[model samples]
Target: MKTSDTTDDLRQKLTHELARKRALLIDRHPNARNSLRIMLTALGVTDVHHAGRSVEVLRQVKAHHFDMILADYQLEDGRDSQQLLEELRQNHLVALSTVFIIITSERAYHNVVSIAELAPDDYLIKPFTADELHGRLIRALYKKHFFAQLYEQLDNGAFTEALSTCERLLGQESAFLFDALRLKGGILNALGRYAEATRVYQKVLEQRVVPWARMGLAMALRGQHQLAEAEDVGQSIVTEFPEFTAAYDFLAEVQQDLGKPVEAQEVLQRAAAISPNNSTRQRLVGDVAARNNDLATAEKAYGNVLRRRRGSSLKNLDDYSNLTRVMLDRGHAESARQVTDELRREWRGNRQGELAALIMDSLCAAKEGDAVKARHAVEKAILLHEALKAEGATTRVSQKMTVDLAQACLATGNEATAQEIVRQVAAENHEDRAMIAQVQRIYSKAGKAEKGQELLAQVGREIVELNNRGVLAARSGDLQGSVQLLVEAAERVPNLQFLVNATKAIFTLLELKGWDATLAKRGLRYLALAQTKDMRNPKVISARETYQRVARKYGVPIVPLGPSRSPESGPG
Candidate 1:
């Protein structure tokens, strides 16, 4: 009788607290909402917000920070609650404090939840009692509150503080102990203490095979520059834990770092087959396919990204640009024209889009044997490039835009302008061997390889001399001069490691002495450029981690500098 009374009192307390929560309930069926409403009412939740569609739920989620969001896993519009969770998990609109609970009737939803990149705080299988629901909510809300500070510190780039918190929390026996260890490993990696991170991950693996921990182990190995070991671990994860979708990205990255783009592309293909609904994975598939000149696969992959990200905020222009390139390469003149026309129609005022569309228009025109129209379109593209010169564009965007322009000029019989543009491109990508090969391919396709080889070697020599000058400035203790010189060199030769490393060194010097806002922005911008040069490159990763340490000091967000591969998604 005493045990029953104690349970009753605890249940009553949870019901009362759950009642007081500012909550939202989402379900597609009216009967389902009625059933859930009755349960909430029985739990003393008198007031509840309701939405039937993903868009409606998103609107409410963006407008308010609710105490709880109970979303049905099954939904309309080809978007399940799992996709919605992934969408909002970017933290752009949803607050970290919000407790999300997935409500599902199907066992398939459980599988989806397991493989999802951004999982809900809790999930309630259908036919659950009001008491059971309340119990799960209590647990989830408690966890949200418990881990709030650690996440805040980490997101603000205070890795040192975050690390301290993780260590302190790990000392206590708790349900979140594994999470704490995982975060500790990440913090150690960000601090460039790869050896320490590897040890922590090893401890976790000895206890159990957790993909999150296993992924951390691979990352630590990669950070330590043990590519072979990292690949071994990554490949093992893929072979042993296929449901751990993150393994594919890690393995593919290792393959790319090992210069096996073909193998990496194959890994992504397998990942896409497993998770076709992921926009990031689709984009990556397109990227790797395009790099391998597999136009058919690239076209399909880019099309998938455009399809999947149709109504979401995560849609990127890169997909459209890449798709457009493939369409033109396939000799689909009318089709390519239609795409460029649509591009111009939508991105009317955007500089990069306008330039890209113009270049595409020129290419299509030239392919159709209209030299005059091609020349006109190429001129517009050149004018757009000149107009955007002073504005800062990402190296990826600039490289694609200029490369398109050069191809257009070459096709239009404008040899002088084409040569100048190729020279400029070669100069900028001086240290990027792959990019140089691509430039040579472009010239060879246009029957100008002799000129391309000459320009590549000349620009490479110029970049070497410029990098040396920047290094001398650093050795002389003229840190500011070193930064200025190296920044210039980096802009002229975006992937030149020596120049980027020198710039990073100056940024470190400034941070050690005192923070300069101007230098901080410059340093981060150069780091962004370096990352785009080689996503899996260890030097770039090290530079990014170092910047994260001082990111808090300089009031910068801890957001990554470039795009990331997706490890999430299965259709509902």
Candidate 2:
């Protein structure tokens, strides 16, 4: 394929394909964008768009999909190309099929590999000719075309089919064997076949010391609950490749799970220092620091999170509440009030924003000793919370915000309301140790640590009893009764465990008693809810596979597992 004649033939074909595709050029300077647009046009890419800022690029991506995106290394908003690429992929704004090329100067090119946590398909050095760009575009387009079927399956959430495609490619495509193995490892990990995924990654590592393969091996180890071994590999990666910021994040997660909060905070802080503009890592630093009772670090991290995302589309109500919570904790009541005011101004008509603002206002007023104002704000917040719950929008509210509301209720002498709110939250998130710790901290602040313990124990018991009843019924061969109990539990609590259980149970019943459209729909809804919580959970994947198998057997349509989104929200 690398022979001159074959390469020429492929380039000719790609040139024809380029004429029918759309492209986007992103550069801070107008002249640079124009020059790139001309080069693309010369290469037969006439349907070209240009953006001068990262925000503009985001807007264009949300409004329309492009076949190719070429962004300069440095963006106008202080974000580098790597950060933009990461954000787009993480939020599912861009498809894997899109060809992304970073255009970097010689000086920046040397550091690109070290700094990039999310690698682009290819990169072009500055001051290159149209022929050079054409050469790179043709190669990237060819690879993209080769994996088109696999990407389609992935985008559709058909993991099983995607895995099969990877296996086929691995056996046949000598040029793309490594690439197929990489995709196969990721798919296996996502489907929760950690043992097999571990083998795939290990096989790759045996051939060469690829960073991605090592990271995949670490993740596969983590999935198998081998936290100690995973931590060792993660530490080695960061030590050997200090510029790999993602290793810092992975190491921190492993440390946190291993009951090393101080270590976790330190690792995250290191990552944040290396990549200061990553709002997600900054938020994680804030969370871990707060849990460690390092209020000063927490305050700075949360402030950075808010500042980085201030005007971006990724900004949300939780950002405001996160900063305000730390500010109030640090006794910066006035500063907290200022942030709340900003939140109100930024989110004027959004109901969730109003709820967040009122809750923050109540906390600030309480901190300032204005009991009357605090009580008034709490009353308003309670009403809004009830309205949202009645409208079935409670899931839209973040767990952190719910904790803040409970804290506000406790501050304003509405102990009963606070207890009930915490009870419901505790019931739903009993498995999340961090969230439970947060709930306990709220109770401890209100001088009811003992009561919090009692309430959490009671919630735990109730959940276990509810789950056990369903399991026992299923064991006794009463599948119908088991489904009924599990469905009721899921509707009542809707936690990941219950939702997965209910979905699995319903599909089992359907397989036995013939498919009932109503029952199948209910099961699919539960599966979707579980995916929202954790898309890669082994149980969720198993449930999804079960539904697919049963649907195929009955010749019914199988719904894709991708999340539904509006046009404004970007690609599904």
Top model number, TM-score: 2
What is every candidate's alpha-carbon RMSD to the true fold?
A: 5.7, 3.5
Q: How many pairs of residues in model 1 come into backbone collision?
A: 0
Clashing pairs in 1: none
Q: What is the lDDT of residue 6 in candidate 1?
A: 50
Error of 1 at 154 (Å): 1.3
> How far off is residue 252 in model 1, in Å?
1.5
Instruction: Residues 131-203, candidate 2: write the lDDT tens digits.
Output: 9998898889888877888887776667788899888778773577888888888888778889998999899
For model 1, how does the per-residue alpha-carbon lDDT over 1-572 read when each residue is reduced to its tens digit?
13234534644555557767778889888888888888878777767888898778878877776778888887775667866777775433555567888888766765876676565778888779887986887777666656677766654444567778778888866679876777788767666688999999899999998777778888889888999999998888778877667689778878888999899999989988887776787878887787788989988998888776654455555556668778877777787787677777767687787888888888888888998998998998888777677565534355756777888888888888887877877776665545676687668778888987887888778877988888798899887777778777776666648545754775677677777677777777777666555533446655765777666677866655543211111110
Query: Residue 1 of model 1: what lDDT?
Result: 14
| Count of backbone collisions in candidate 2 | 0
